[model samples]
Target: MRLFRSLDYATDADPNWAGSLLADGTLPSFRGGYVGISALRNSDVLTAVSIIAGDVARFPMIVEDKAKETIVPLENVEYLLNTKVNGRLSAYQWRFAMTVNAILTGNSYSRIVRDPLTNEPSMLEFYAPSQTEVDTTDPNHVVYRFTPYNSGYTIVCQQEDVLHWKFFSYDTFTGRSPLLSLGDEIKLQEQGIGTLKSFFGGGLKGSVLKAKGKLSADARKKMREDFERAQSGAASGAPVVVDDTVEYQPLEVDTSVLNLITSNNYSTSQIAKALRVPAYRLAQNSPNQSVKQLSDDYIVNDMPFYFEPITTEAEMKLLDDEQRHKFKIEFDTSKVSGPSVQDVASMKTNGIIVGNEARQKLGMKSIDNPDMNRLESNLNTIWLDQRAAYQAAKAATKGGDAHEGNSHDDNAD
Candidate 1:
């Protein structure tokens, strides 16, 4: 019995031919059939066996039930030995074949691969069997000879649920095939892996986006008009000018009221009422009282005197010395009296009283009357002594014996 089946022969062989061979018990006789036995093992057949053995080696099987038959039952043997075996074989041909199966078949056993940088899912597909050259010039390039049509299958490669894929092409030169290169897919996977790591590792989810708003034109216009109206109203309501004026009246006085007050010596209040003027104003305008002292009697007597408001030259001149002197004498012009000798003598001795009252009132003192004859005698003695001293000084200047004589002369003088 064959340990593994070839997916190419199983899928490509005629179903009727396979059924007829099974019924006729000629299945093993058919080339590349399910139960075929090779004379000398084919390289293709060995390659298939090596792939399945590698899977079993990596994940070994154990027998769970001895009584339930071999752990993988004969009923499940075809599926286990063929379908599952083929699925594992497909991985070596393309990098992301299992990932493709996960996406297409929705198999829980298969998982998507997430790219580290882009964080997207991905898968892979095999190159055609005839293509043998794998472009190795650029690390990131995957040059393949592929027919956009007639491609058999697609493989889904993933890391953490993201899907990725690579399409293959046919090469005219080499009959045997190589992998459709996957460096670009690897780079894409790395990018998606980085992005996924960031998402799970805590960071911003998407690209930055922004927006803004502004006032409408009509709203702005309305606000401006309202402001202008308010300003205008305030300006119009302000006061521009103010009124301020004064009034005057005529002043009057009664002559009869003044005459009546002067004739009867009426009270100051009665006079003010008759004249329609205030009492204080009337009193302020009245003349002050005058008093004179008699020299012979030493008596102070008040006199009825009116201070005629001195307005004329004649009245101003009445206060001058010449006019005052004329008014001072008691003269009878009708009798024509003349000056007496005693009066004339008094006037000749002293011109007039020029001393102030305090000085005139002071009495005579004894110290004021000095001895004039004694004073004259002392003055004569001083003059004689000075004349003698001068004569001696004149003699000494002529180089005479005048020292003794001068002393005698000074003593005598």
Candidate 2:
């Protein structure tokens, strides 16, 4: 484990020797395409990242028993995941933040703090991508160099002490940011957004003023300003007292003409694809698809890419060798794509699940009655064997009791 150092020579030290630019004192632009973390200013990027992170945050990791093939909850892991990760954030907020960092920067790092006596993991302290660097100089013993935000010192630790999640990594050490690859698309989106802002921000409707004769620079400038003022506000309908040299031709403020909206949509779609999120999830119109279809597409196609690595990393790093052999960690996505009401009802009716299990899935309270917990038969909630026994008992009671009553009635008569 490593701790803070003196800041006297920290700034003077060249970060190049530290490996990647992430070791720099300032947050460097990730791959020179977009500003690091500032790329979230683009609405599509923000939306995509939020969707993935939020989905992951909703479900905590579950520990599985390998030999029994069942999920078993570990109290410490459960508390760490469901209650709190460290002093700064709860489990949900921490997970969301880490996921956002991973999606945007292609890498997320967390220092694993262990108990001194037990040597078991006690806490996970998250580090920003900008503050963390991979020291790959030693191929055999790769280590992590972490510089805390706004701090004057750096900490160096072994690979085992840090949990690293990499996305789209060519080198096994660091992951590549998605923005680096989607540079063109992001540029197109930014340009379209700029054009839209100019269109709306400027009071002018983008109409053209034609001058057949060559006008001086000052005259041309004056004419353009006059034309814009005339076309907007109360003066819009007023007749312009321009000489015959100038003619005003009104241009419609049509977004279709500029193709900005179309280009923006295309850019957003491409970004969604790059992030492995559905276009609809980024607020793109999907008139043809239902909400359920879009949700299913997201859960089936995109979630695994974002979630599997995190869970796998947790299983490997959070647990010890002895524990790893018998237990594994997994995200509880059962509720994410759970069965529909009709499916749950059918399962209960057909005895595939008991009433209590059905109630839990449906978010209903469990019944205390023993009969409600019993397996139901396909016919009217009674088991086939129980129904048969019930019918035989009723038939014998009817036969003997009715005969006895008739004999008593005859004797009385």
Top-scoring candidate (lDDT)? 2
lDDT of each: 0.29, 0.74
**How high is each candidate's TM-score?**
0.14, 0.72
lDDT per residue (tens digit) for residues 363-407 in model 2: 454677887678876545666679989889989999999999999
Ten-residue segment with the worst summed lDDT in candidate 2?
Answer: 1-10
Write down the TM-score for model 2.
Answer: 0.72
